[model samples]
Target: MDKEQQIAPSAGQKGEEQHAIDVGTGEHGDGGGGIAGDAAEASENERLALVEEPGKKKSTRVAALDAFRGLTIVLMILVDDAGGAYERMDHSPWNGCTLADFVMPFFLFIVGIAIAFALKRVPKLGATMKKITIRTLKMLFWGLLLQGGYSHAPDDLSYGVDMKKIRWCGILQRIALVYFVVALIEAFTTKVRPTTVRSGPYAIFHAYRWQWLGGFIAFVIYMVTTFSLYVPDWSYVYHIDGDVNDGKQFTIQCGVRGHLDPACNAVGHVDRMVWGINHLYMQPVWIRSKDCTFSSPRTGPLRTDAPSWCLGPFEPEGLLSSISSILSGTIGIHYGHVLIHFKTHKERLKHWLLMGFSLLVLGILLHFTNAIPINKQLYSFSYVCFTAGAAGVVLSAFYILIDVWGFRTPFLFLEWIGMNAMLVFVLAAQAIFPAFVNGWYYDSPGNTLVSWIQKHVFINVWHSQRLGTLLYVIFGEIVFWGVVSGILHKLGIYWKL
Candidate 1:
């Protein structure tokens, strides 16, 4: 990674549960999703902050990677903050893919590309592992602070969460976990010196055999556990009224194996046991299912006779699903490795096209055949293939436009946002800045600067509510953050991790 260009990973947007027929955002996650943060995204920022020496700039960082990362952050902000106004920005309901469904996969894929570069030539195992561990911790800290039930942004003034109820899994947490595990595999197996493997089309595969094995292990674990494990009938305490004063207990029946229904999946079972039901993400996307709610794909009143698990919380980024997600990062590493070894541009593009198309076809086959449906919430194997493959194709476009064609002027906005991803996501994407401004009001708590601007300044001015809200999000929020990030980048103020 180039130290000077090194900045925070791009990311944001976590939709819990909001269902209004008029409000158009699709069903999404309980916790936020991450951009593909480089292992170096955090570490390299520290370097650029302190030193900008030419001698330290040993390798040229890929600008396209940064651009792609920025795109993820931008998309997250658009989907998360503006999604309510536009259904197109929303994630899928359950089984199908949508615009929002692509965000997390893109994030993870970029993180993988970064890991390859950051650990291209690890000199010392202890030192590299320590850096990876520390970065992981930092990423988790930010994720927890933003999504671990403490932040009731744009709504509640309270900022404390019960320790027992704090969410244990989320976007950055998953990124941190994937980064740590993938970096470890690369550090352990990657040769101290680069080996020129010019054997054939399978050269890179052979060279990174051990790392591939590591990915294979992760894949095997996710698959075997998902299929073979028995999910027992379990009970979780719930609040019938959503009031702290009163609560209820619900038992979800799932005394079977290989069941992938929204209720009885082994994926949810593993999460229940590992993170504990209360600690997992409480606002699962599945709450919008037809069987659970009066409104499908949107949060509304519960059905007259909702299933036992209708309101049950599940973690999309849980331990087991993450094992499936790891393959995404590893696939990205392959792309990065191609960049490292193959000198010719044609070779890199060729490899990427082959890999990307292959996975896409496989994923489609799996979904159509019902072998594994493409469910983003489940992080299913087929979903992994489709998203990762899509990521490769998207990255290829970025590489061509930004790096190959010298079209930097056009994507300058995204470039700026990508380079200062951390600051933008924290303040704008996560709604932290808006929430902070929401504290004061002339009459009531909701009548603050944030609401005033969105309502009176933007929403009211426009004839249509949906159009007004959409425009406000695009300009008031996204474009505003873009300018802020651009200014900070110009001033050499980069916030990472």
Candidate 2:
């Protein structure tokens, strides 16, 4: 489609500010479009006024970025609420990639891109650092508050709070850590040049050469540390007995040499040593399920039973692996630099595609070499390369279709969700919608609205119980949050952290 050349101007705003590839041209093809556009513009103007110093022109937003973020957020909600109904939608067991594995890396990649645009607008590096620190703390607080601090039996909800067993790290905590590290890198590494002089390819290279080098250095360090680090050998640790000595006699070995087992990996060992087993993820697959048994009516009893390797006491979003996550953010920062440096649409698209393809090829090659497996839990070099490449390509497609060719309306729903991403994420994860859904449940059968809807509506219509439950959770949450985000967008009520 020669879509690269079709750079449609964002109507009503000065044509000088390009919308980027994923952002739609701010032109309205119908009456609803005008109203929506006006509302979005008003919200953005207000946001800029709050963050920006007085008298400076409001920063132009790239709709594509918001759209991209919105899409990622939607998918996040879907997979999260899927509740392991679809095995493919769940994270890969150990050493391979899956559809569910890309979300966090994609979100981190976007954070790097946003940092590039954000820091450029601020005049003082001190102020930028302060803001970054505050946001990082906020993310950490929310992550722990919402996802950590408590563990309870699935069948019982009346247990007392267990202080000794509370988890500390979570999804948002990882994001917070990654964002803090990446922002610091940007603040120190990126050169703040005058806005008048166009940032050419050479200029960008000169400015960010160190960051590129730093990213490479980080990647090498991660590979060496992950593969060479000595970890406790727990290959023989069968079950979690009350006595710690049962699992304490194992020796340590290098992770690269067949030590990637759940209990033996360096990442899990560090976490357990630091946080204790009770403070880590409790229901790791290594813990045998209550219902699982060796015998059945049709089959004879088995000789021995043990915890599955999949359930080893390891946190995918653990501390040690997050170092490689920084590498993913570094890739995003590189993309952000390209977006800011390149003057024309063609230049940006060309560089983005080149970068995307190069990453894809490199990731695949690394995977094939078997030196670094594409493991999401470990945040392996190959995993970051592949996901970052996929993210870049997806952003490019959005740029071409939405910003370049002017296909905007179909994605307006996503834009609304993007506008209040963090706010909606917290709301969806924490109180608002979940409380509402819980309100419908009752002790007796046929009294709860959720069960009735699943049984009659989704199950009856789809003719599959699994599909019905999946749709009910995924679509139900998406639609609920979509409406909430839409109302907030219309009313200009964005809650930024």
Candidate 3:
């Protein structure tokens, strides 16, 4: 992928297709009774993203959807770049929830919701499958190129990775896999028309009940394999560039079943067996935990008494976790169905609140009882419930504020960021934007504009390393990208697979 990637190819198609869509007239006022459309009318290539052009009365995009998506993108950028500075905002080392842990589920949830709108209209099976396949392949390719241990980016300036070391799964890769699965289910289920007598208040559920069943099946598979699969002792070699002791072998003692710790877990074991150790993410989030690092929650040298598995690699977006995460997308799909069936704001919010509350309560029950601790690394059932519930509540709130009351001014930047999510994600969160900036340095590679601004502007002004890094990420990174994304949105430039 380029520093700046492809614009949505369906822009013209979106314009052409808007003629057929009956856009809700409540663009600025209290949302009126919506149409229970047969399905969404979005073009297949840009199915996951539906953006309404400014002042385009017939545009199919919902302001709340864009704003919700934008918010996740901003949080994604914030959490990713702000790691190791503050413990609260950082991803939990293990078995806990933090601000950063919400991004993955939120994105997946948003995708689920988008899938509903994208396939809102009855789609031609051949064309829809073609788009889905192309998009999935593109997402996988980009995921591999951006991550996959190939791109050290501006930090190392290397562009080569040993085939043995290329990671097979990551954030986008997981999204691609889940999107493929969920989109297919939603596509087929679009034929199941809702009926007043059969569904009543549960029409949305009735239409997409297959998705829920699939989710339950996935949950059962995850639970059984997580508890029953035996994990044997695993070993890894460690090396630090410039350190005297670079090559050291470490063996982790497992030889047991149903492990949830970072070292000996079924999730990690399945990933190791399938993808191979070198194909797994080398530096896991757990390395910063108190068990491994000398400075807990901060990336640094290892503790003197670190566990043997501390040196081992773990893939957070491994197969089991990815399967568990499918539930998140399925929940989003349910919300999408609500949008389709419920035309009035009152009905929509009512269903959303009840469902969100139920999920939240069940998640809390599971967590407090130790049935399943909230673990993002494992993508535990409790994590899925809690985060997906939170996502629903937050989205409903956005619908009220942006869709109902028309509070779009304050969140305009977020809207822009959300509208061009794939673009902003690539440019900001993926280090491509920083690398592009770093490409223009004053003499030494370290003397880039980004380094100067962070140090002299944010860091120097704050007068503390921790505070400075935080400020730079918020202002230097987030704010700057917001403006850039806003500009791109204005230019009618957006990204798609």
In candidate 1, stretches whose alpha carbon ends up further than 4 angstroms from where it belongs are 1-61, 240-246
Q: TM per model?
A: 0.86, 0.78, 0.87
Per residue, candidate 3 scores C-alpha lDDT tens digits across 249-277 of 87888999987888888999999999988
**Residue by residue across 359-407, what tens digits does model 1's lDDT show?**
9999999999999999988899999999999999988888778766668
C-alpha positional error of residue 313 in candidate 2 after TM-score superposition, expressed in Å: 1.0
Ranking 1 against 2 by lDDT, winner: 1
Candidate 2: stretches off by over 4 Å: 1-60, 151-161, 190-203, 234-258, 284-310, 429-432, 444-447
lDDT of each: 0.73, 0.63, 0.75
| Alpha-carbon lDDT of model 2 | 0.63
Residue 300 Cα positional deviation in candidate 2, in Å, after optimal superposition: 17
Candidate 3: where are CA atoms >4 Å away? 1-61, 195-201
